[model samples]
Target: MLVAAAVCPCPPLLVPDVAAGAAPELDTARAACTDALGVLAASLPDRLLVVGPAGQSGRGPHPEGTRGSFRGFGVDLDVRLGTGNAGPAATERELPPSLAVASWLLERTGWCQAPVEGLGVGEPLAAERCIAVGREIGGRPERVALLVMGDAGACRTLKAPGYLDERAAGFDADIARALGSADVAALKALDAELAYELKVSGRAPWQVLAGAAENADLAGTLLYEDAPYGVGYVVAAWS
Candidate 1:
């Protein structure tokens, strides 16, 4: 069992730009998550890039310089998941794992857009967060499959899990629901997040995961839940 990781950092699912007139509910994002997982079911990846966030700078430069950032865990998923081969872009229907996070993102709102690039970050949680993930995996010498997607700041500073269980106490419920659901569905369906991790036989601890759960909370924003992986207990703290 080799411990490997991948992340996919994404901007707010429903951007003010992408969903101007359309009024999508968390359920809509849920619908999108459902469709996205279906796509992932057919096509799995080698590694998982987990992205993070960096919050917003409000409107400044450009037409709308409302630069939101992330320092969570998923950004690493975006870059690592498809690092080996960037052969071609995924089709609207194809839904690559990185962009697949959009499925979960869609569950939240219809008022934001996916990030265009990775830049300008805030406090990142990748190093400390992933360590818990990695340790739970126990540095297995096998292909560790993960689904990472958060903001860019956290994405940029991809690090191992350190002593970073500082914010697990004040998490809300929405974050919990998202991670819990994602983790559960991934495992049960053996098709989505849990589904794929099972393919690689990866596992992490609940307490370990809880340490970095805030990465999801701080950065998850509108994530529905953590899809299941293998041998891993879902640990989430949220409002």
Candidate 2:
């Protein structure tokens, strides 16, 4: 069952090399992510599962040694899911961008408490399916810890990626509350249609988290919340 969880945004800019000089802008978010991961380590889970949005439906079982790269984002940097073997032949598939960001975070924090793996939830997946996947994850006999990575709406401001949607703020606010309070029902109830319109990519993975924590009695803390580039980025922890 899930013993702990950390919620983070999956922007490639989180990587200093990808962001270049703009890296300092996300320093606080980076720190919060590190702290959240530390909480997961404290939980001493039997394993860690990094969940994130993917281009396709249910795209992973990304093994501990799976590889990811940021070359497409203008950097040649590469990351592995855990301290497993490193090389081109380590795994058959490359992680989706969101999972790549997750891998980067784990590498940045030097995670060592448990072996790491990954699962990619499709952006448009139904809430019911997302929850079901989460339940299956929690059903594993050993204790599991999760690192959920995905961004909230991208239409918060005129300069946002989705370009100024009046409803963006409210949507992000609700998500922030649900995450901050560990409100499972709220997460599971998030409207997928509306989320798609708002450009929020975290709904499926967040619902998955809710399913895993259903009866886990986790206490949540909102570590960070912001629309730095008009995209809602949040960092939260539950333990």
Maximum-lDDT candidate? 2
State residue 74's C-alpha deviation in candidate 2, in Å.
0.6
Please state the error at residue 165 of candidate 1 in Å: 30
lDDT of 2 by residue, 115-189 (tens): 888898888889999999999988888999999998999999999989999999999999999998888999999
Q: Top model by TM-score, which number?
A: 2
Model 2's alpha-carbon lDDT is 0.91
Candidate 1, residues 29-98, lDDT tens digits: the string is 3444444333323233232222232234311111111122221322322211221222233211223222
Candidate 2's TM-score reads 0.97
**lDDT score of residue 30 within candidate 1:** 40
